[model samples]
Target: MSDRLRVPSSVSAARTGAPFIPRVLSIAGSDPSGGAGIQADLKSISANGGFGMAALTALTAQNTQGVRDVHVPPVSFLRAQLEALAVDIQIDAVKIGMLANEDVIVEVGRWLAEVRPEVVVIDPVMVATSGDRLLDPAAEDALRRLLPLAHLVTPNLRELAVLTGREIGEEWDAALDAAEQLSLDLGTAVLVKGGHLAGAHTPDALVDAARALRQEFPGSRIDTTHTHGTGCSLSSALATRRASGEDWPTAVASARAWLRESLEAADELQVGSGSGPVHHFAGLWARGSVMTRPQAEQLASDWWEIIRPIRDGIDELPFIRALADGTLAHAPFVFYLAQDALYLREYARVLAEAARIAPTSEEQAFWAGSAQGAIAGELELHASWLTPAQGITAETFAAAQAPATTAYLDHLRATAFDGDYAVLIAALLPCFWLYSDLGERLHAGAFGEYARDPEHPYASWLATYADPAFAESTQQAIAFVAQAAASASPEMRERMLRAFTAASQHELAFFAAPLTVAL
Candidate 1:
């Protein structure tokens, strides 16, 4: 769990920040069954902590029983979507699930070459769990064409057999050798999924071609008919991890962990009949696990890179650092707090969602508590820091914002229609830590500058973040969320990540504060 990645504690104090959201693109077919194909890919992408965008290659009339009919889209249309996405939003990573025909695959390959994305995951889909072929006979050639361009290729046993021209065998080493051969020949990492390998538990193997890295993942073999779309889910999850800047092997490892939870819990209830779909939105309430603080530090590195430099110009007062030192100037601090409070109102909803979908009550409680704490804690910090400004009052604070309040209102209106809690939280993350980080830095080595002002508050605010207990608590929360993904079937965990991404992006947007008002 990388809770520390989002909100790290300074060991002596606790820290918080906006959030890290990964973005991904899925180029594949659509499954009307909504279990497999591009549908599953999108769902999996969201579940796995990345925002998912899709370019459809084919459309399938399918159901839990089996895929009925798949209509392949023209290569031109597929290319169009790919170009549009590449030219506009940055496509962090790409997950290619089901390219119905060779032409489609060719177009996808061409797009990849043009875009030159850093991470590409190819899930060779030939046979379904129900033993039906999805790709055309010529699809293999297309897969080979794109394989060298991929960072990783995920193929199930049947597809592995088809790709390697080997029978499904009894030896694990044989499979490893085959996967290794394919990796060597194709020049890309490969993951030979062992879900069908007749075992009490599921085992997935990842071959790291770059360093000849080999790793095995042991996951729960969930017993249920609700196991549709697992491959699409895994590929999307892998892509998300990669887009988040994880190495190829680490991305696959995390993807495998997320897949297990989704599979095991697919039958938690029923989404459809026959082979039902897995639950992809399970990471909102990661049970109370603690994560390493280093991950938080890593994420902050990016945040600081983007915004801190521009902040000093927001106001000449260095209101944040001044307030931390107990300086008497209260006007700006109160305004900042009010804007933040309004923003946190939305954050609470996400925490509520995190609490709601958790498989267990304890995890739910954690989310619930976090929601309350973030909104209230931040509010209290504002008041405490603003209390001493000469003649400053809460009413005065309310009057201070036009830029901040307008920003908050626009965010509110935009998110008003979004019912998902995870999305809301993603949107609100930036408000919490950006200012704090700014304050901490501005006061660095100059804490005594505002010493004469009792109302100015530097040490107190710094003390709050510097608390070891607070930092530990933040880390614990992060770890729990990671565990939620790690312990689940790949699909469910992936969906949760998508939700996480949506929430994170929203936070990014909050700061970007689009003129259009995305709320």
Candidate 2:
């Protein structure tokens, strides 16, 4: 049988053509710290596309460091909270966490039997990440009785051991064996988390023993201490996704991906001195601009810094050093110039395309003029060096086009045709930025002073790039691309950064091509 949740038509139907938002109810304890229990559940439900509701079983005075004390409310009051929502609101899914005693567990189980939410995910929160016990020893049997009421049970290593009445070993395989047995005994799916295991990887598995099915999700362990509410958040997210009609594996996969992203950004919060809370809204805050976006100039500086190694590699290339000191062999120099001529031809077309698709007239004009310069100015310089009398003709230039030259041109062409204006401009910026920077450095005697000497064999060739006008144009290109990136959406900014990095790598390859092929 398929693992997909069969969402009821009432739950799945669109209201007035609006998207159906699952009404996810959290039957868990309250955490004053707002990191775990019902607090984390509500947050995770909302973040995962659900309208959140809570029916508290207990309340805890706790912080990120540890739980100080717990208060269990009257079982009648807990029943009242569950009943009130059941009468007025249709709950699409329920996530249960941290029932402090047998009475609380029994009450929640009775409510589940009556209300019967379409999706039920129970996070057996028996022990805290700080090694504090949340569940009472006497309530363990009651919690076992409640397990069968849930469609899925999320258990950490210790919790799984308690539920299965088996001492689970430290290895992941042992955890899976226990999970399989628990799933068989309880007649429900089990989400066995490997976060507490010893290794570089944290693997989670969904096991359905009746169906003889097991799907393992492998993940790298994030080096973080701020995992205060990971189980609560993940279970709630899974409940929300299942309520939204996702299959078992897909829901687990989606929740795990979101959880990992949250963990990665957890340190940014710094909420407490000990184990901290994950940033529940990291993706939303970034994309919604709640997080500060870097300014254009700062972005340029950051991008330049990010590619320092690539820049250094270009500087160390024999081709660049030899051309700087005018000691480059005739064959390699001619080969390089011929390839540059061919590259300029396609690079000019890409620049023209960038102009055609530019959003603003100023940007359009700048790209158009740069395209003209690529064709007229750069090709003319290449022609001066790659003369037919020197045994380098149009055929010679075409035939000598190295793989690196073709690769660089292909990158530009692909970006120009397939990517957006922001991404295309970012890809184009590296050529201008790297060449001008290298040119200025060579002129200032980075390689040798021969590049500036009038009598140097390649002096005029080197001077073309070092010209103040070219440097000015490079700065202008950088400003335009950075401005475009600054106002872009988070997703667009990432694409731009990737394109810029790839282009920088291509620049290094293009510079190293001549000598690589010659050698």
Candidate 3:
């Protein structure tokens, strides 16, 4: 299966010949409220399309409100979960979030000896989203042991400051400098999430790649109390993307988008009396804007530029093509849609949030109505797809999918959080527009032979893609995203452009022509 079809799911109970799935083992503390720590890590990994497993070092009493009590697990017990998962399941990825003390950190680090997963995304969980220190002083030293081995070490501004003992001093350039210094010191891919610091946009930098991506994402600056799990969410998201095979930079981008959306959407939900949490499934219910035909049509014409490499060789890409054509044989798609429905349920609310912070009510209404329509349509679509004789339970879908390609989502997250509105729109376009185009093209043409000569269950699937309105909406979305991305500096514009290009490639792979290496 193509990475585009990837979903993050770890083998919970090991069995022989288990179908391949992205596995992420999280070593961290547990959050009973499911907002931060290991709980947050598991949710983030699973939500971002990975199989999440956990070995908790501590359990904390907390909610959207705050952490009240913490019970540290004996370090030996922490090591056992690590050993058990490592021994049985093939862990594709590992995430370290919220280790309470140095001993526990060292224990997990030592346990790392046996498993040795390919990708390790360390969140460097030093501080909570509420600005409380979660790791003990000793853990910092243990963290150093894994830095050299980590694929990526994500640190927010404060963590960077604490780790490097350098004042990043509110300047974007300074933060980048600090991140670079940390990378040099640790010899690991370092991501400095500048979300908490001051700036018109939250710019994050990935310092390992030869060409560093110092990006600033522009989005609605949400003023909600539910940001308790942002850090855990972001790191887990990055880990999920990384395990799915994206390079570190792309994974960072993916993590950023997922986290930003969660935060942006949190503005609408009322999870607690103090500060509500961001709704994880907001996208399922919300349709902030209608993707139109012009946008879809233009993409249909231009998509070849991005996807022809993958599409013409379509036969080799049976599973992904199915995703594109909505003709995949798996029953999981129904559950996948159910997951998406839960997500879309809040999509409009998030869009409403975007409008609430938007400069105009017109944009607000557009988003609000879009969310309403999206909710209704999404619910119906999921119901129809799931209500059939399909054995598409949520868990079943979780089990069947493979890992995904995330460069596109990363592009969007970078822009959505730091770029202007136009950039956000541009980043989001491929997801909406390209999928529609791919589905339409295949329905009308390729990937249809799988169905018996008499009928095509893939019928309406293609229509959703071919609709001119869907294409048109894509154009407007492009305009919206591009217009907002008009930056003052050439560098800024170039960065945004790079983000767009990278995202375009991410879209292309979904419909990549199946490559035949036949001799």
Candidate 4:
């Protein structure tokens, strides 16, 4: 996993004051089971921060088991739906899926030529997950003609074989060759999916013949049969990310990451007995109880539990364990103190900004006092550790600042300036809550007896963690953030949860920095 958290492009853009919501259109067939085709497209688009609209080319009687039958509407009605949306709304991107026949393909091609949407992602949905053919074999030529109209075409192994007129091979090299040939012939980028290959890892590549680029995205094959609409969901998410100002590679990477998470959480839905649908809003649903309307304390507890792995990882770090046992070398201990001093400098500023944007007088006063305490109290502790007798000077202290420290401060600063009060406070809470919790445990001899031993080398530092006043401050911070989240809109609450989660992860990274640099 990447150390840096990646906020979606739409959210990042909003932080920069653009606030653009991509208007995405899905021109595809309909699945009554809501697993694939236009249904999956709409869900994927919305989950990726796009406003989704749909124009149906056909309707399918299908479920996770298989496609029972398909009914194509007249080409005229499909054209009417496309024209109506085109005239009324400004489409930022278009996703084409399951064009049932030659006429529907040609109709969508014509509309594309006329409207010229900014980004077009075509998922050549020829076969269902159950190996049922959705497109007529006779329409292959027309579909090939329609390929060049799209910015990118996503094709599974079988569909690539149909497009390239070759026997489908089980080798990854053969797949790449076929993808490159299709890209060359159609003058568009090709996303070659390796789901059909017999392997432990499912790999994907974006081949652009014109640019002479072949970017590979390696992934593990999720051991699940419930990926009913992965292609439709991925293509729609790719289009939405592109429309939100991400480049082709970035958009594909983001969409693939999201799809993997959806697949991981697929079993939670249990929509069908056979192959089931991927949970479209898995990340949002997991972040907070958006559907259940949780109380403030419940939400706070959930957030803490969600970061349990991170907290556990922190406890097992060499730096943390060494410090708790009072066996840490002096240089590394001084290094940690210097980095903490650097972090508290920016952290204090973010706290002040939180106070400025706070809604109530109580919140404002709490944040403001916390900021002052961070500077006046925390920095003083750090200063005593960096004495000249320790051979640490001003220049040495400045040089001790690490990249992990900067990354944590960057997240806090970004949230302070760009995010609302609710999210900013959420981002700020992890520092108080995690440290206080760790301190209280250590003071109570959770790790060892050094924390309570006055003669211990780092007893002063450990004593600070057990401070009753600081524990009270941490509780107040948690209560304020939880109350704010409870009162927020569902969307805003989700954002808060994401901010809190990211901050907790950063805290883990921060604690690992000193030993990482020493090694």
* Best-fitting candidate, scored by TM-score: 4
Task: For model 4, name the residue pairs that clash.
Answer: none
Q: What TM value does model 3 have? A: 0.50
**Across residues 1-519, which tens digit of lDDT does each residue of candidate 2 receive?**
123235545444753466888999999889888888899999999888889999998888889887788888999999999989999998888899889899889889888888777789999988766566666777987888888888899999988977777887577888999999999888889999999998799999999998798999999999898999999999999999888877789999999998999999999998979788888989877757566877999999999999999999999999898888788888887777777888888888999999999989999999999999988788877877666455435653555568898888888888888859999999999889999999899889978877888888887778888999999999999999999889998789999999999999999998888888854
Candidate 3, 414-437: lDDT as tens digits: 565663654444444555555665
For model 3, give the 10-residue run with minimal summed lDDT: 510-519
Report the lDDT of model 2 for residue 483. Answer: 91
Residues 1-519, candidate 1: write the lDDT tens digits: 111012111111211343656668888888787887778888888877788899898888888887677677778888878888888886667888877777877788877777777677888877766576766667777777777888788988888878889876646677888888887777777889887877676688988555577888777667776878888898899888777656666777787778777776777647666878877665533542334323434433443354444443332344433444565344444444455555555556656666676557876787788778765675566555545453334442553334645555455345434654433433334433444444444345344655433344445655555445555555555555454445545455445455444444444433333222322
Q: What are the models' TM-scores? A: 0.53, 0.56, 0.50, 0.58
Whole-structure CA lDDT of model 4: 0.87
Better of 2 and 3 by lDDT: 2
Show model 4 residue runs off by greater than 4 Å: 1-16, 128-133, 291-519
User: For each predicted model, how many residue pairs clash, with residues at least 3 apart or on different chains?
Assistant: 53, 1, 73, 0
TM-score of model 2 vs. true structure: 0.56
What's the ranking of the predictions by lDDT, best on top? 4, 2, 1, 3
Alpha-carbon local distance difference test for all models: 0.64, 0.87, 0.62, 0.87
Error of 4 at 226 (Å): 0.8
Worst 10 residues of 4 by lDDT: 1-10
Q: Rank candidates, TM-score, best first.
A: 4, 2, 1, 3
